[model samples]
Target: MTSGAPSDWYRWIPEQISARDYELLPEDFCRTIEVVDGHIVKCESPSRLHNRVARRIATHMEAGRKPEPCLMVDTDVDVRISDVPLSLRRPDVIVYRCLDDDAKLYAGDTVLVVEVVSPDSSFHTDTVEKKAAYAAAGIPVYLIVFLTEAADGIELIEEYRLSEGRYHLVCLHTRRLTVDSPIPVDIAFGDLASG
Candidate 1:
C-alpha cells in the first residue's frame, strides 16, 4: 500500500512484507510510518525544534561518552524488538554499542534509545507502548524528551533505566540534566534547544 491510501491497508501485514515490498513502499514511508505489531503505524515528524533538541542531545552524548566504542546516531533506522508480531520500532536517536563491524544493530547493541514526544496520538504510544518495548528489548537506557504543550509548555526530560525486565524512572529534569548510565553525558535543553 502507498501513503496515499488509508492506513488501515497497512495495518497488518498478513504474510509479512519482504525487503522488496518495503522498497516498493513510497519514498516517504521511512519518514512517515513504521511497522509495529505486524501493523503499519504513522509516525508524524516532530517540529524543527524537536529535531534540534534531538541533535543536541546526541552531540552531547557523543562528546561525553566514555571511551567505549558506541556511536550516537540520529534515528530513523528500523530496530526489531520482537518476532511474534514482527515488531519494528524506530526511535528518534540511539546510542548503540557495537560488538563488531556489522552495520545493522538491534536491542542487543542499543545502549540508549530516545524519543521526543510529539503532539499527536503517538504521544500515548511513545510514553506507554514504546517504553515497554525498549525495556523488554533489554535496552539499558530510555529517555523521553517532552516538548508538546500538554507537557506544560515547558521542556521536560524523563530518563528510565531498565531493571529486572522493567523500566524504572531514574531521573526527571526540566531545564538540563546529566546522565551516567549506559554512558555519561550532560544534556542542557535550555542551552541548546532554547537557543
Candidate 2:
C-alpha cells in the first residue's frame, strides 16, 4: 500500500464551519484564520509594530497583575465567543483565568481582550464589529490601541468596560494607562513604542 504525500491530505475547506470543525483543523492552518458567525475568515499578518505593541502590553499586564486570581496573559490566542453559530476571534493580547488543563479559552474566561490597530485593519471591523461582539459575549473589558500615523508607535489606548450589557468607554490613555479593574494595570505609553 502506498501512502499519499502530506500535501495530498489538504482538502478544500467549506465556506462555513462549526466550532467542532474548526477544532479539527491543523494548528498551522488555524493560526491563519478565524471563525466568525460560522464562516471562515483569513487573518492578515499584522505589522511588526502591531505585534510589538501587543507583546509589550501583555508583558506589562503580566507584571502588574494580582496573584490571587492567578490570571494568565497571552498573545495571539483564540477566544471562543459563541457555539451555536460558532464565532471565534484571535485577540492580539488576552488576560484570562489560568486553567488546570490545556483547553480552549472561551469569552467567559477572558478578563480583558486587547486589539492593536494595524495599518491594514478596517476601522469598522476593529472599533465597531469586534467591540460589539466582545460586549455581547460579556467580556469584562476591551482595550483598543490605536497606532500613530507613522505606524511606528502607540498613540492612544481606549479602555472599555461592560456595563448594563453594553460597553462604556472608561478611559482614553494617551501618555500612561492606569486602571484598577479586573486587575491593576499601569503602563507608560512611551515604553510600548520604545525599543
lDDT of each: 0.73, 0.84
TM-scores of the candidates are 0.79, 0.91
In candidate 1, which residue pairs get closer than 3 Å at backbone N, Cα or C atoms, i.e. clash?
Answer: 11-39
Error of 1 at 169 (Å): 0.7
Clashes of each: 1, 0
Worst 10 residues of 1 by lDDT: 5-14
Per-residue C-alpha lDDT of model 1 across residues 1-195, encoded as one tens digit per residue = 464444654454345654445545655655677777666677776787777777777777777766656565556677777655667788888888754544556777788898888755468888999998899899988999888443333368898988999999989977776887666777565655764
lDDT tens digits by residue: candidate 2, 1-195: 113223432464566787766766777878987889999888898877788889998888888878887898999989999997999999999989997556989999998999998746646678998999999999999999988864337788899999999999989998887878776778787778776
Best by lDDT: 2
lDDT of 2 at 2: 19
Give per-model CA RMSD.
4.7, 3.2
Judged by lDDT against the true structure, how good is candidate 1?
Answer: 0.73
